[model samples]
Target: MDLEKPPAQQPPDGCLVVAIRVPVRIVMLVVVLPVRMAWDALVVAGRFLDDAVLRPVGRGLLWFGRAVFVWPFVALWRWVLVPAGRALAWLGHVLVAVPCGWLYRYVLTPIGHAIAWVGRGIAAGLAWVYARVLTPVGHGIMWLLKGLGAVLAAGGVGVAWLVRYLLVVPATWLYEWLLAPVGRALVWCVNGLVWAVRMIVTGIGTALYWTCRILFVLPALALWRWLLVPVGHALAVVGREIGAALGHAWRVAGHISRAVGRFLATLFRWIFVEPVRWAYARVLTPVGHAVRDAVLRPVGEALRAAGRATRQALASARDSARQARADFRRMLFGEPRQPRATVRREPAAADTRTLGSSTTALTKD
Candidate 1:
């Protein structure tokens, strides 16, 4: 099935909007158009200046800065600082790391092991004393505590019975029979007094509330509703119109600026860029190609051939020097003997063990 697209929605507009919009937009446009055009002109001037002058100048300055300031530091880091850092690291390893490692291995490790052995011996002695002497003593003391607890528990039960009869029973009876009725009567009298006082306070508070509302609050509410609200709404409407007009004018000015820029760009391309491009393609390219083929290619090949010959000669000389050094070394110290190779032998059949047979020396038959 084919589906039709929905129509675009339009914003709701009233008579106030229609009356205010046109004049506000006209005023905003008059104010903004000149500014937008000047902004567009400045933008074009800045871009042209960057491309023709500032960019090339910046690049040349960058190259000069690198030669004067950056390259020397780079060379120093590569050639001098790197070697010094490596030498310092080797010295640290020898003077500090090696000595610390040697002390840890020989002196500290032996002392720690001796202290640990002594600690273990002390721990064993404490464990033996705890098990042999303290354990028996603790058992005997626990037996005496059990007997004393039994005697104390019996006396506590007797004292509890005496306290219940002598104090608790009489106190409970006195509260139930004598004090409860008097307390109830007092509570009833207090409730009556509280009710009377609450009624009098309620009447006074209600009268005060209504008096305040009529005198102060009602007038303030009337001022807000009848006077301030309408004035505020009028100011709000003016502000809204102004903001909407500025936004609409800015967008229209942007469109005009974009169109002007495009026209200027097209004119510049036709008047300047096309001729330069044509000259480069039709004239410079062929001349450059002819020069490269006739002059540069042969010189490059000759230079490469000379470099290869020089490299081969240097390699031959280096090989001859190495061979002479080896011969002199052999004359001074005799030829080195190669190491002899050893053979690995497997067990004989008589020595081989099966799963059912014992292979261990202690268990073998």
Candidate 2:
């Protein structure tokens, strides 16, 4: 009945060993199988995500990245890459600045000083060479100028002497000879002209005297006798007629003078007394009074009114100015116009004196 006592109940260690083996195998199978299945499922799921969603998203992301990063790459090329390259190039120059400054200070400065010294030596040498080379030339030029001046002076003197000898002496002799003959000929011509003039004057005087005697004296005597008789008779008639005409003209002139004097007296009396007196009584005095009353009186009244208005306006302006000045004083001093108590903080005499002087000047003004 006990199933042969279950092989007499195996040892606990053997039973525990058997039980551990089965459990280990079961555990391995259960854990390993499910983990493998789960791994396979995860792989499948990852493939599915990649094929369905991740691949498209990755493509889109890559496209978007290209689109977005392209401009950035261009910007980087322009801003960073180009600038970095330029900076790298300029770095060489910037790096050289300190050394260059140092070289210039320490090495180049000395070299420049040496060059200046050498230039001075060269300049001195050139000066010496120029002195050596130009000394002869200067002397030669001076000698040439001296020789030329001497030649010119001598030529001028010789020419003057030659001209005096050849031209002046000959011209003097020729002039004397020619002028002497011409003077003699001119004297002969003058004497002949004088003799001819005397002859002609004598002939004309004789002929004129004869003609005057024949023409003037005989005709005058005959004409005087012929005219004297007629003239005596005519003068007698003219004297009688003239006396009669003069008497008539004197009577007519006396009549005209009386008439003109009477007319002038009447005209003077009428114009001076009657017309002027009438006009003065009727028009002039009354017009003078009317003009004075109408025009001058009104003008005087208007002027007085304007003067009063102007005085009022000036007074108002003065009051407004006084008010504005008061307001300005209040704004500036933060007080009304009343004597303020002087607070002496340090008792500076100069400040007090200045303030007192200003206040006295304002009060006086």
Candidate 3:
């Protein structure tokens, strides 16, 4: 079954026909012709008045203005204003900057030097006072404090000695008389308790070890010697052979699995992945390209045409406005010239692609 899209709409044949309004336009021109002629005649009269009377009078007034006002003003600016400004500048510099510089150099410099010298003298006096008077007084006070500290330390030693001689002697005597015997009894009791605990722990460990040797270890040794040795030796030889066979089988299975996995991987890559890639690259990519050619390109062209039409309309309106303004000016001032042509500008192109590099990259991949 065909799943293609339907055909696009077709324009009607009669859309291109142009209707003429020759009779109405002729009637309108006939009706308004006298009024337009009158307006044009009035405009011509205004132009003649401006050119013949107004222009000559304006020229006389311009000459009068230049002679009566402009030349004298120019002369004052050149002679009086310029010279006065220069004199003012010179006077200001000589009165302000020169005096200030001289004062700063002669008066302020000496004052600053005198102040600095006084400050140096004061600093020297302070240094002398610190070295001669304050130093001796500070040393005498420190010596007194040291002597007082030494006396206090000696008193503390005497007090400590008296305390030891009194309290410590009694404490030692009491410990020797009463606590020493009690401590020796506790020591003896602790030693006896430790000996009893050691003997009990040792006896329990020896008994448990001997019991295990008799019940479990002896039976295990006998079973190993009489029964387990011969049976285990035979089993070992059999197990070795079976293990070798199983190992060989396991190696074969591993190789088979690896080969099968590789085959499956290769099959999937070819059957599924390659087909999908080819479909994307040849089918979907071309479909996208067709969409660009059929839909986007036409749309872009249509939009460009519409934009050009709109710009032409706006330019026409602007030209009409400029001409109207010029005509109005000419009617008022009696002059008219052809209007300048407006510059036409092209618009920037718009992007119409819905899918970008992402589609191409996916198709390639």
Candidate 4:
């Protein structure tokens, strides 16, 4: 039912539209072309001026700064300051250090050593005097005391001799002259009495000995020979046989023990001793040598170096102490002088002779 058709729209003419676009293009060219040409020319002029003038001025300023400040400072340090410092160091070594070393080594050290030697000599002389003079004097005094004791002993012997001569001789003579006859008579009576007693005692002892020999010794001897001797001989024979049997058994056991000991010794040697010896010789010895060479040797060297350093330090310290002592002694005593002694002049009387005047005149004539 809604199918009716609508009327078509009429479009504008193409020639009139093209005529309007051509006039607009002509107006734009008149307005924009001159302005674009002026902008392009200004940009080209600016680029030319920057390239020709400004860049060269900046480079000139950089080169001038380098030449005036940096190059001069480097040159002064290299040419003048470094050489002057080296020269000063060399001069100091030549003038100060070398002379000090020479003075210490040559003059100061020898003087110190000489002083030490003189002091040692003085000490030795004192010791010699003590040993030679004082020790011998003490010994001589001891010997003198012993001689005095000997004199006292000799005097005691003389006193004893005097007593014997003065008293004993008189006593003996008095006894011989007065009491000898009486003493002889009394001695004769005592001898007679002692002889009677000894004779009786001998007779009694002889009777007793004979009676015991006949009554007891003969019967005891016969019984021992017949009865006790056979019994003792039979017991001795049985003991000898048993002792021989025990001795034989002991010898057999000893032989077995010695054999077992020898076998054990042989086994120990073969199983343990030889193998241990071989291992020690081949393995342990070589390992020990390797460890010694690689580790112990280096350790020993380090220790030796440390010891040398310590020894040098100790030597320096000792030298310092000695110098200090020497300085102190010098301050106290000013200077030491060598010991001197003067010999006394002997008396002149032994050099002169006295002569009789007449004899001298006769000899001169």
Which stretches in model 3 have alpha-carbon errors above 4 Å? Answer: 1-141, 224-229, 243-365
- The best candidate in terms of lDDT: 1
Q: Which model, 2 or 3, shows the larger TM-score? A: 3
Q: After superposition, how far is residue 83 of candidate 4 from its true place, in Å?
A: 84
Mind giving the per-residue lDDT tens digits that candidate 2 earns over 1-365? 56554456643544534444554444445445544545555766799899999999999999999889887899899999999999987997779887898889999999999999999999999999889998878999999999999989988998999999999999999879998889999999999999999999999999999899889987887777788767876665455445544544445444554566567668987989778888998989899889999999999999999999999999999999999999998898897568879976554666554544544456545
Which portions of model 4 miss their true places by more than 4 Å?
1-239, 317-365
TM-scores across all candidates?
Answer: 0.57, 0.25, 0.29, 0.25
State residue 346's C-alpha deviation in candidate 2, in Å. Answer: 30
Clashes of 2: 0
lDDT of 1 by residue, 1-365 (tens): 75988888978877887798899999999899888988989998999999999999999999999999999999999999999999999999999999999999999999999999999999999999999999999999999999999999999999999999999999999999989989999999999999999999998998998998999889999999999999898778778899999988888998998898899889999999998899899999999999999999999999999999999999999999999999999999989788997753544577775656566456669
Clashing pairs in 1: none
Supply the global lDDT for candidate 1: 0.92
lDDT of each: 0.92, 0.78, 0.81, 0.81
Candidates ranked by lDDT: 1, 3, 4, 2
Candidate 2 matches the true fold with a TM-score of: 0.25
Pairs with steric clashes in candidate 4: none
Model 1 worst lDDT run, 10 consecutive residues? 341-350
In Å, residue 182's CA in model 4 sits off its true spot by 52
lDDT of 3 by residue, 1-365 (tens): 87998899866523212121333334445554555545555766799999999999999999999999999999999999999999999999999989999999999999999999999999999999999999999999999999999999999999999999999999999999999999999999999999999999999999999999999999999999999998897677556545554555455544555566578779999999999999999999999999999999999999999999999999999999999998999889897567997754532246322344332435434
Worst 10 residues of 2 by lDDT: 10-19
> In model 3, what lDDT does residue 119 have?
100
